[model samples]
Target: MIFDYLIYVFLGIGLFFNVLAGVGLLRFPDVYTRLHAGTKCTTFGSIFLIGSVILIGLKLWWEKDTNGSVLALHSALALVAILLTNPVGAHAIARAAHRSGVKPVRAIADHLAESPPLQTGEKTDKKQQPQEEGGK
Candidate 1:
């Protein structure tokens, strides 16, 4: 049936993107780049894969199957969950990595360094200032 062919095509496309994500994870030089590739590719692949499931569910439901309705609903919920969480999780991971002192390759300016979070006023010695006007 045409629907079956459609499912196969979706699955194939999903598989391709998923594989690309894996390759990107391995090939990218830095954490941010890897996170970008991994998150975007996996999210896109999951959309197609879940879409195929939804289509199958709809087909079955059209044939008056109760289980198909459940499958479709659950697949839709899962897709929503993936859409919401994937990017957020990736962003959290990248932020954590940066905070932990991992610098991006060839990055010139770190904006986070310019504006720090509000701090309670506590006097601390400025370490980076020159101790003497000339070399002691």
Candidate 2:
């Protein structure tokens, strides 16, 4: 009784935030803002979604026997997987976007302007060549 109501509540919250994330992705004006909303909102919503499943699994396990235990354990593993992957993937995407030169819109200042790109490459242009050539 109470468990079912809690599961429904979790699902509702998850769905609401997921929708908010979608709206933020579409409505945000800049890459950084969009990324912020997309990552945090989706992660929050996903936690709730997975939490609902976990509750459902626990309910089944409480009510039933061995098979329910498997379901509950697998859901727990899935929740762990989501927790491990989401932030790492979000960091990778943000770094990739920054490295690939996607600047934020209407940004007044950039603190990372002095920071060098993560992966260095060989200087391919003569402008970047060493100033060691003798005068003619």
Candidate 3:
């Protein structure tokens, strides 16, 4: 009885986090922030959700039922799917956002933007001037 109650508690907690993730997605402003919130929170929440399912599956399997074993195996596969895809999806979103120029709010520094200017004509020497070396 106590063990069953514990399983229910895990389930409830998992559901709560998933719900919180949804709320974060709806409430956050701008694309970057929204993506950040959506990706991280949802990933975290999903762990709990899947963990709860896994626990239930484990409990079932412990009871020596055939269906429980199948359920547990499938739940593990689902967890793997979630783990592999979440980070990759988040990376894709972040890359797309960056390429689209959706800058983060109040960003003071841009390291990539500060790269040295590119020379159009040719490669310049370290100690000599380009104008003296190549006459245009």
Best by TM-score: 1
Scored by CA lDDT, what does every candidate get? Answer: 0.87, 0.78, 0.72
TM-score of each: 0.80, 0.78, 0.74
Model 1 CA deviation exceeding 4 Å by range: 112-136
RMSD of 2: 7.5
lDDT by residue (1-136, candidate 3, tens digit) is 8877877777777777778767878987777777777777777777777777777778878888778778878877987888899989988888677746677778776554312443332244444434444653
Clashes of each: 0, 0, 0
Candidate maximizing lDDT: 1
Residues 32-109 of candidate 1: C-alpha lDDT, one tens digit per residue: 999988999999999999999999999999999999999999999999999999989998898789857788999988
Q: Order the numbered candidates by TM-score, best leading.
A: 1, 2, 3
TM-score of 3: 0.74
Ranking by lDDT: 1, 2, 3
